[model samples]
Target: MIKIEQIFNKKDLELFSTEEKNILVNVILEKADVSKRERKLDIFLLSEDVLTEQILRKINQIISYYLPQTMSVSIHCDKLEGENKGQRLVTKAWKGLLQCLFTEIPACRIWMLNSRWELKKDCLNIYLEPSGIEFLKGHKICSIIENYFIKLGYPLKVVFQEKTEAETYDVYEEEREIIESILKENEFRNTETNINALSPNIIGRIISGNPVPIGNSIKGTGEIILSGEIFDVKKRELKNKTTMLTFGLTDYTGSVAVKIFLSGEKKSLEYRFKEGLWLKIRGKIEKNRYTQEYEVIPFDVNINEKLERMDTNPEKRVELHLHTRYSSLDALCSPTEVLKIAKKWGHKTVAFTDHGVLQAFPEIYKASKKIGIKPIYGLEAYIFDDESPVMILPPDKPIKDVTFVVVDIETTGLCFDDDEIIEIGAVKILNYEIVDRFSGFIKPKRPIPTNIINLTGITNETVKSAPPIERVLPAFMEFLDDGVFVAHNAEFDAGFIRREASRLGISFDNKILDTLALSRIVFFKLKNHRLNTLAKELNIKMGSHHRAVDDANTDAHILQELLSRINEVGISNLSQINDIYQLRKGVNNLNSYHATILVKNSTG
Candidate 1:
């Protein structure tokens, strides 16, 4: 079935989609044999069971796209199966990962090209040059890379390993030495008295004026004094036999490029103009003609190494609200690293209120629990509640006397004719307390979709050992009792149950109460009424979101909270609860706020 020629023919393939690149990343170069004119490679990849046939085809296509034309290439793809597949993907993808890194972060260049990486057990051990390690540690870059791959749909770790002597290389040696020997043959007299004499004291006298911060220096800021550390230095030889040394300078406020033409200097700026060295310069900001960008030209340079410091206040401060990578452009830090830093900084508790979604909670839970910090789950939700309330209640009964059955269900799929119910969970509440519970899994006719299996962790094997929906539904219907049919979204759960009952020619009718409707009116100030959002706001323990029992149990808890709020406002019965649904008119209801809600204890 595989087309061998198109794959083997040398086709220039510089373009690839994100998904295609990820295919390249999750492969290991098991073997590579290269001759003068040809190259052969053996790559290990996920088995066809783990990846679909379409995905496997795409992976082969990506292999063809990435291999160079210089060699007559042959690649043998070998499939890996079982538990070790994860480790294989992690270990093999490091080379392709650099490409992903560059695409995600523009500043992540080819500095890590020759670095060594391997996945041992769970951690991705990376061996980088010393400077590369410093840069990674400074920016907290490891977790970001890990999280990037996570969003690409796999879980892996990134940990920096000490570079052994064999693994180490001078990443900047070429840039520093290319124009170095030419500096010894100075056309002018030997200009150096002592390069070491150009210290802070002498440099202070040379300018004697406050240095303009590099970030604030604009083009045409003529002959101003500036101070910063050199970060990047590169040397380029021109056709005219002149040498150019360009280095990036930063003062923490901003950064700028400083250019120097090495025509007659006696000493190499490689000694002073190199990366990580601090310098004070008298330079004029001018636009470069070739690159068409503003840069600096130095008049005089001196060593000015400023002492580094950090504020180590040991006071424990509580971080109530923060955002993670889920908060759009607001935050990019991975929750794992951010929570770890919070614990390191003596914060015992923290909360993440990502914008309008509870999708980040799972990551927060896993990360914080690992680091011994309390995670107060919350969100900045979008609220738009202006719907009329639906109330079907016993006319004169007080709230305490009536029993409420809060029900939740998990299904094979959404359609009534096609999909069938797989699981049912229900909780009975009376006198504001959960009095009883019912839970069961029902086998469906069709196979469960892969996504549903992931979301609920329920498999065909799990239901195969259980009863069918025809048998399970009757018991669930009987468990509903004469109580009011209650659910988070009553239209879905109760309606689906009713639809199934109609097939059996059985009458299914109960006074239905929608907790979703109650939440909208009761918590009108909330951004939106998601189950997790309502749970976070009301401080209820939502056990597991997509599961039947957890959601139904949580719905019962929300009902109690809504009932309490209703009673405080003088609503005595279910009919009066609907009166609260009328919009709070004449007020500026259009405006909404990003609120900070927190969990008080472990249950939350």
Candidate 2:
């Protein structure tokens, strides 16, 4: 019979030899006992350094492959002789042997076997190892044993040897004295509570280390607070007597929209929320990326318990880059009309530079701010004579001989003499469609004001970091070589480009067409000519109103509208129409006049 006994003194622990240590390690490994008590045997043997490098390496290999994190290993030894030495050797050998068993066998089953050893009198007598139970307790290894036993339809019990009466009496006396002294202390009474009378509510309030029951209950509606803007609300009818309210709300936490299906009691929330108002909401929170936050929604919202008003200032400051009917032949709305709509859509500020003409800028600028939207002024113009418009806007590969370029320039202030071009934006159109675009903000050889930065979202920081205009202009001219210049107000953009090119010792001579004139001849209903109003009237989605790409795109769209109008008016050839239009506009010079008339008559 193995008598299990605790090794309390160092002298008794010294009895193990390298061989015995190895045998013990092998025993624990074979037993598959991972309990803290079983593991202590490994710790004890490891402390003695009885393991060989080959064995240690094998153990480490197993651990690394099976464990989540690396574990520390140690080996300890004092001598190398006797059954104790043989036992150590056996234990170390057991470590390797146990690995083979555990390679296929589970650690839990080993724990179950170890736990059952306490119940077996012969096994318990032979092993008399208190360290086994202590190690198990430290590692909470008995829980794994309990789980295995439960799965096997068997109950597990941990049995300890009964203590003598004298021993129990001594322990009771010691505990009693300690308890009495603790009760006599003032601080102890405040911190310690009687466990019997503890209720859930009292348990929650108590801060002392007393065990308490945790109960579950349905959460009440009074706990949640909801606030957001009502972006949309729609009422829909259900079967016979039911109705539904679909609403959307956006807040800092992000947007949430819901469809509430209702009958009688559910309709009680009807008075709580209204269209375009803020309201406090109560409902089960859900997670649905497709919808609000939840896919499978659970609770119906109890809304209208609270409502708050928010400021409704329609005009908000935004970047100014928009186009109107005045810039496109098919555009139907004016700059003033676009501003009015922008005001309705809650724009705080607006810009009114028509395609090429600043003509509507004065009126729209005056009217926009009066209606609470700030107004900006700028034009979408054209670049010509530097490169073929085909380079910018290429036609469909199957078609040939139709090309145009639209351009816009931002300069320092409005004075023709003092202000110089600070930025250039252009797009090429071929077969009446935009094909390519160029946008660059140039650093003028002068300082820019804070007002310009605030208005244009451009600053010294940007220009200081950009390449010099002298470097950019040549590249731009090279890109624009031989393209027909198309602009809302052709003269302004063409005049600026011509002036800038001549300053750089380059000639600027290109055929030009004004989208403004084309719009006047095609769609005459505009009260005022501006790009944004015309774009909106034409149902174009105008984004980034003042940016070059946006304005160039709008100009390209205008060209498309013009060609469609020309087709509608029975004009068959674009080259011929463009020549006649140029002659009638009186902007054509002697060379351009003869060339255009020759092209027009020859095409006819």
Candidate 3:
């Protein structure tokens, strides 16, 4: 008798609240289909079986607020005989009321008949049907019912009557009782506080926010362990007296030289050297030049000692030189790939010597250390003299050509000893490359003029904390390994070295070579013979033209190029090149007498 189609219309939809309107729209959208001609629904009126007084109150409130016309809404409890005419009329009236409420409130409605009440003699049997569920899916209608109950401050469980058993329904009285009990138990109640009940360890952990106490100690040999990348491992002879393991070590503390006396079995030390593992040095703390900040010179190093993994600090060890892919005119590799190439070449030591800036050093050092290779610190510096830049080589040997020291000096002016060396950078080179390099700001025995710092980029802040020349010279000498000292301009660096060495009461008698002279001889046709020009001509990369390490490295590369050319021309001995250079220096112009003397010497 109560028809859902008659009540469901746009005019009826205007009666619902905003939230109910949204729910109605969603329900209708879900059920409506363009393909369908008509949709059917049923309406039902049913009493809540398990609903308590609290739930009924909430339901009444929702009905009053959203379905205002349906005030005094009630659940009727009545038994009806099969197909009784009066009972049918009552049911129809109830169904009509449900249809009106569902349609007017702009909501989908479903009813559940309490099937669990069927066994009770006092329970009323009922039929339940959806009033407007054709507008929404069953699950969606159930969600709406749950949301509505929540909004109304009721916590009753609502479920959809199955499609097959649309006429049968049941609800449990015990379910409502259990829900009420749970809500009651969950109401706020604070526990009694007892500060003394906590364990001391628990209290400590809570206070410190750490699982273990800071005071906890681990038992071991009390020996302090240090792990670092081996910057350089060279057999150095110092003062023409002591042969020592003059190696540079870079760790978390900082980079410094570790001078180990080579009295032990050479084979034993050699095995550890070949292992090429990052070393864990356990030795008594001894201050050494190579030891940048902290010194631990072990008399015996266990090469087998496990290398601890450490993160490379970007601030400490930056790539002073590197070449990008864009450097096609000279360099053939990217900054990252250059490190890979160096690693492949079995070069435990490498410096990025890229033209200008320490930009690439960070990435290069990070990548190199990952592959178990320690990079030697250096930069290939270019020197500009009289508007012409020059490359300086590591000094020659007796004074071995392969083993020479790379030195960088920041001077007040070009006159060497007259212009004090304000800063010094030195690295040892063997086999035509940098093995290790040292860099430090030096306090000029005299005030650093503004012009000097501006030109050299060495600020007062940099040299402010630098050790005095007296302190720096001795450490520098030890780091040099009495090897040939080299720089971009040999005369400039040699003058500073000789002056500084004298100041320290030590004599520096190492042989010297100018890479500028070497470059001029090898690439004579180049228009300009400056360091930058020669580096570009020879396809050599450089970095920070004025910085000592960078300039030193540029000098190193120029030396490499010259050595390559010498080897090409079948000149195996460096002594022959030195003799030729010396002879050329002796004669301003080669007359017949000089030519005959030179031929006689060549034949001899």
Top of the candidates by TM-score: 1
Which candidate has the top score in lDDT?
A: 1
Candidate 1 residue 263 C-alpha distance from true site, Å = 32
Each prediction's TM-score against the native? 0.41, 0.31, 0.31
Candidate 3 stretches with Cα past 4 Å from truth are: 1-401, 416-418, 579-604
Query: Whole-model lDDT for model 1 versus the true structure?
Result: 0.68
lDDT string for model 1 (569-592, tens) is: 888786676777553442233335
Q: CA lDDT of 3 in candidate 3?
A: 24
User: What's the residue-level lDDT of 413 in candidate 2?
Assistant: 70
Give Cα-based local distance difference scores for all models. Answer: 0.68, 0.50, 0.48
Error of 1 at 141 (Å): 4.5
lDDT of 3 by residue, 316-419 (tens): 44343445644335566765666665555544445555443455567756777776666543444443322122222323333234576767777777775367
lDDT of 1 at 144: 73
Q: What lDDT score goes with residue 447 in model 1? A: 73
